[model samples]
Target: MPFQAAPPPPAPPQAPPQAAPQGAPFPVPPPQWPGWAAQPPAPSRGAASPYPPPAWRPPRRKSGAGAVIGALMGVLALVFVLIVIVGALVGLSDHDETVSPIAIPTFSPFPSREATTDTRPTRNPTSEPTSRPTTRPTPVLNRTAKNNTLYRAGSLAKPNCRAGNASIYNHTQFKALILKTGTCMGKAWAPALERVGIDWSPPKYMIAARKGRGACGDYPSPGSNVPYYCPSNSTIYASTSAMAREYGPLGSWNGIIVSMMAHEYGHHIQSLSGISDSWWRQTLDSGSRSGKLALSRRHELQATCFGGMFMRSIAASYPIDTTRRNTLLWAYSHLGDPPGGPRDHGNTRSNAAWFRQGYTRPSAYQCNTWAVGSSSVS
Candidate 1:
């Protein structure tokens, strides 16, 4: 055979390319590397892989010396980082020692008026609510008369009272004077009673032509001619005939009549202030006639003092001159427990002394006859 280059090995047979199946993605060619062999295409879904299985190999063991050296270097780096952090903290602490504290602004939970719209009506600062009163209500009763709150109520306020030349001899004039005096007494006492926590109401008056039955009993009981106060009805019952018989010509003096009325009104005050009730209870519990009489004397003497106190309060307005004052003192001196009588009322001297004390003193404290010695009241 002629020496010709062996014909190139016959080219390997290749399968013909097929058309892509319906709805199948276009095939992607494998990437080529500079010296590596081309890898087969990835298998289609559900097809066997064409690549060989990867071979398993033993894990490489780290060198002990190399691990130790690497660990030491890591520790050194951590130490350096810790040192840097500690130095920064120390520097910050030193700087903070000289720094002043900052004040934080405070905010209220309530909204500011400018930020919120108020729909409510404005309230007047000066106006008080109707539900509350300007003053407290007066009490109905007190504890005792001797050391009573009335003593601390200061002086009695003067009221506009005028005798106006009214003579007690005339029936009409006497009744008018009594009513006017009663009204003035109420006005003068109301504020003082309020101070002592006691409510005050003017007592009703019944000036009868003849003796009649009253709330307590018959008006002119045996041996009693002056007017009497009935706590049960808060009324002053008096018989004009009885008063005329008892006082005689002295009743004509307006000052004398006024003093008598004031003494009776003093009983009304005791009733209203609970002093009469307390005294009655004590009198009943006294058991002995002498003890009861002593208590009675004290009570009656206090009335005289109260009468003087009221007269003093009206001295300026009623214009009680030296003559009227002398008349009052003389009347007080004469009005006392009669000799060989029950001795329920105090002696003439003691009664006059208490009246004088009240007239001279500025407050009810001087009129507390119960606080004095028994001999003084006697």
Candidate 2:
């Protein structure tokens, strides 16, 4: 249960001064992941997978994998053949051919049969190579391979990343809310991931974003701000309060909220690309900065860009009518910055400008705030 940290505490809903300024149009929309969104009709783990749908299994199932297994099987067959040959050699070496001049009945063609030792040419035995029994070695267990690329899967195809609507607000309902959100966000990012030549094939990787903390649980240190992505777990989770505070209260945009989920999805892509690990390691030696802020900021800004990339993909995939299109843009602006509040939350100016860049040019390279200097942020 202990990955790094709790339960639903009172999340200060009323951030008195941090509240959106007056006349700021509330970027509201229908709640996340409409309840009936279709799940990817594929099996994630098993029949009762976390994905909730079955995968496309091949009609004529394949029995064997490939090269490695075949190589192993071939070696086994060779060993069997060698063992037989070795046994025959040992038996032959033990038996000696006896030729005795036995005095027996002489078949009369005179006494020709009496003393005949018919020996042609003497054959010399040459030493044949005998395979010595070699001790086959066992491969060491690689703990890293098991956790090389971890991922937490969300409940696919539920509405608003939650199970029920306004009627419910319990722990179970909150978890379902988080699960629905996480999976939907995962679904949202799947396309861009493919476009970018990234592979997200499961068993390839996914975290079941459990109701836990830090590495595997809820974020914003819990009861701080909205639910967010945790880079370590490569996941995004939502609690009921976090959902209510972010979505239910129209102080933000639903599209941007979903975009934030996609932003976290960007971090997942970062993890897969091996970029996050490098950043984390580099930060450890980066004594010049206060802790890991430098790397963290890069990660955060990049995720924002990735969120925009998802939005771009979404727009391209479907027709966003005039009203709906504006809704997303409004949502983006509304959720940009919540004033000079929490360090975890990006500042308004940086948020707006970065979102602008992402909307125009959607790629990780375009959002490299690290290169432009820290001064570029303000």
Off by over 4 Å in 1: 1-108, 112-115, 118-142
Model 2, range 3-97, lDDT digits (tens) per residue? 10000011212211232234322113322322336667666563564555577877775456766788899999999999987776566434422
**lDDT of candidates 1 onward, in order:** 0.72, 0.47
Model 2 spans > 4 angstroms off: 1-198, 201-220, 251-253, 288-291, 316-319, 322-324, 330-345
Candidate 1 lDDT at 103 equals 10
Choose the strongest candidate by TM-score: 1
Assess candidate 2 and give its lDDT. Answer: 0.47
Instruction: Quote each prediction's TM-score.
Output: 0.65, 0.45
How would you encode candidate 1's per-residue C-alpha lDDT over 73-147 as one tens digit per residue? 999999999998777656644432211111101122233433223333433323344465466655544458665
